[model samples]
Target: MKEIVILGAGYAGLSALHVLQKSSADIHITLVDRNDYHYESTALHEVAAGTQSGEKISYPIMDVVNPKKTTFLQKTVEKINADEQSVLLTDGQSLNYDYLIVGLGFQSETFGIPGADVNALEMVDVKTAAKVYEHIEAQLKEYKTSKDEASLRIVVCGAGFTGIELVGSLVENTKHFAEIAGVKPEQIEIYNVEAADKILPMFSDKLGQYAINHFKKWGVKLMTGKMIKEVRPNEVVYQNGKDGDLESLHAKTIIWTTGVSGNKIVGESGFEERRGRVMVKPNLTDPTYDNVYILGDVAAVMDPASNRPYPTTAQIALKMGHYAGKDILNQMSGKASTPFSFKSLGSVASIGNTHALGLVGKAEMTAYPASVMKKVIADRSLLKTGGLKEVFAKGRFDFYH
Candidate 1:
């Protein structure tokens, strides 16, 4: 049996393990992740919001790694030795592989702003979400005895889906926690700061406007067209782009969701990265080595239609994982497998409970229907990855119920 080691059991790595194991029963596989549980990263904001606990978003990685054909190792990968066909782990040990797959998730990028690293709460993974949840809970408690509500300000830096969605979710949770703590709803200021001309710059202008409208309706202060010059322990200084004005805002809480790059190990390793992602060939294998494959956030793939780098999404990551897994099987078995070409399904984001915006194919949706679909996607991910048994173990037998 051939040994194929997959690093990082994220969306891509896990999906690859599932697909390739089923694709070839003769191949032996081992999946590794730094953490023991696989986090549902798409729903991490909810976990941070106190709306959902972090446990709901994470499943044991070993339970999902098929035992018949695969092994699971909870260890952090130190470096990849492409020349030796082995990988170094943090435990002072190494594993040699006949084939390798890289699917490490994202790392927070502060864009070189001061104090950003020390102060900003990064919504990177489930653990970070738990930290955000705990921090918010602690802050709310601390504010209960305090008189200055203005000092309880929360500044969410970035207007992307993660940032916008977090603020949207955070507002309601803030309100809930505020009510519990006897604080006025209006007292908790949730400000969303964006450097771009508009929020959700990747979405259509209309969609962005809809999101902005929703934010305003939720009492979230929209600070658009502002660049973060510096992040202080007690304040966030910014250059407001309104009429070329410079302004600053003070906040006790700063959640930084500005940008993300591939995990540190990959970028610093021998892999060639164009934008914190390995440049993989059509078959989703790294250009540097035939035995090594790159998927998910670690791989930079071009959109054939536009020739631009595709935005990293879970849908693409899952598909890319399967592509790599099957292609590797094809290569090892001397069989034929098709190159990867992702078919865009659609995406939806929850603004708040029972409120969401969805773009499925050409149709656009907001409100209840979108929220329902969002639930479906979230539940389906757990079911698909861990099967109905694990889903039920999570108390999700009937998805809608």
Candidate 2:
């Protein structure tokens, strides 16, 4: 039997496994991951903001994987030896594969900023988000007696999708947290710092304006065109611009959602990578090694329409997984694989619990309808991954809130 090893149980890896399992061909599929549970990474921000529970964002790997055909190994990947077709696991075991799928996902990119890696709270995983939630709650509880405004000051780095969504959730939940802590809403301060001139730079001007307006109305301080110079336990230092003087913002909590790069293992494996991501061929396989496929945040594929690399999003990752599965099956069947052609499905971002912004096809949406669309997109993902049962168990059905 062919030994097919799939690494990392994120969106891409899991989707590939599901599609591959549908085939009747006899193959040994090993799904390896550091965590036994597959996490809804997109919902991690909600967990960090205390708007959702950790249990809601995660589900057991067995919930979706068919044990009869697939063997799930919970272990961390230490290295990938493409030349030998083997993967070194941290548990002192080595796994060999006839076909290898690397979807190891991402790591927080601090851009070499000092102290940012060590000090900033990242919204990368469920555990990290829970830590952030606990920290925020502890600070809120302490503020009840100490009345320290510093404890209430929150500085969120990056104004991209993840950063903005997190800021929105924090803004919406701050009122509720203050109420429970017997403090006024105005006592809380949230600063969204961005290096760009405006938030949501990749989006249309109207949508960006709408998000900016929402931040303004919600009392979220927008610090645009500010570059972070350093991060500290109690504050962050930033420069106004390229040649501007340095300034400082004191806060008890500093969230760094600035950026992400491919996991280091990809580069350490000796793949031609830029920014820790492998630039894969049109078929989503390594140019030199046809047996290895990369997807999600680890694979850098260019979009012919824009002549730029596709942004790392859950939607794109899901599509990549689907296509990668097909390609692998074709290879196994001795049929030529087709090139990957991505279709634009638009995008959505939650501004708050009840508010959101979206661009589906050519139409733009905001507020309640956008919020509903966001949840619909989320539910659709779960439905694809673990069927209707998973949707009912972990789906976001409370759209009106």
Candidate 3:
């Protein structure tokens, strides 16, 4: 029997498992992850913002595992010895594989800013995301006794996709936070700090401005073009644009949503990588070893049109996962595997439960319509990974809200 070892129970890894479990290919699969549950990476912002519980976005890993053909291991991966076809676990066990799929997901990228990693809260996984809301609540609780206005201030360190959505979710929960602090909702100030003058550069100016208008309407202070210099305890230091004036914003809650890089294990395993991402071949295999597939955030597949790697998104990750499983099956059957290709349907950003903005194909979507599309896309992803069971259990059906 062939031994297939898949690492990380993320979107890419789980999607691969979903495909392989139904096949009678004389193969035994071992799925491994540090956590026993799989959460939607796209919905993490909601958890961090206290708009949704962590359980709402996550499901147990064993729920989708086909026990007859697949064994789930809840262990942390220390490193991968690609040349030896083995993976080392942090618990000091080594597992060998005939075919390996590496989809270890991503971590917060601090960009080497001083105190960013130490002081700023990172919402990379379910635990950390939950911690963010817990910390925010603690701050609010403290404000009731301390009466420190800083306890009500929230500073999100970046205005990227995740940061923007997080700001929206946080805004949605302002009343909840305000109730805890015994203050008016407007007293709980939220700020988004970004280095770029332009937000959502991937979308048109009109779409970006539409989001900005909502931020303004909702009382979210936008501090664009400010390069974050450092994150201190309850404060963020930044440089004011090209003029380079240093200023600091004090907040009780500081969220680091600046950016993310692939799992560090890829580089530690001797793969050629830049910022934890490997530029893989057209078939999504490691350039050095055909039997070793690297997908998700770790694999950098080039976009022929742009001559640059496509942005890492759950949409691309799912495609990569499905392609890897299919390609492996093809090779086992002595059939040629085809190069992977992807054309994005579009991208959408939800400001709050009821508001959103983006493009669907060539069509522009905004307001309630875009919000509905975002939920539909998320439900589609859940369907792909967790099937009908999870879609009904944890699906976003509150479209009217």
Candidate 1, 216-308: lDDT as tens digits? 787889988898888878578888785576677877678899989887777677788855788788888878798899888888889988798
Among the numbered candidates, top TM-score falls to: 3
Q: List the pairs of residues colliding in candidate 1.
A: none
lDDT of 2 by residue, 314-371 (tens): 7888888888888888998899988998887888999777888979877999888889
In terms of TM-score, which candidate is stronger, 1 or 3? 3
How much is 315 displaced in model 1, in angstroms? 0.4
Off by over 4 Å in 3: none
Rank candidates, lDDT, best first.
3, 2, 1
Q: Which is the winner by TM-score between candidate 2 and candidate 3?
A: 3
lDDT of 1: 0.81
Please state the error at residue 25 of candidate 1 in Å.
3.8
Over 4 Å off in model 2, which ranges? none
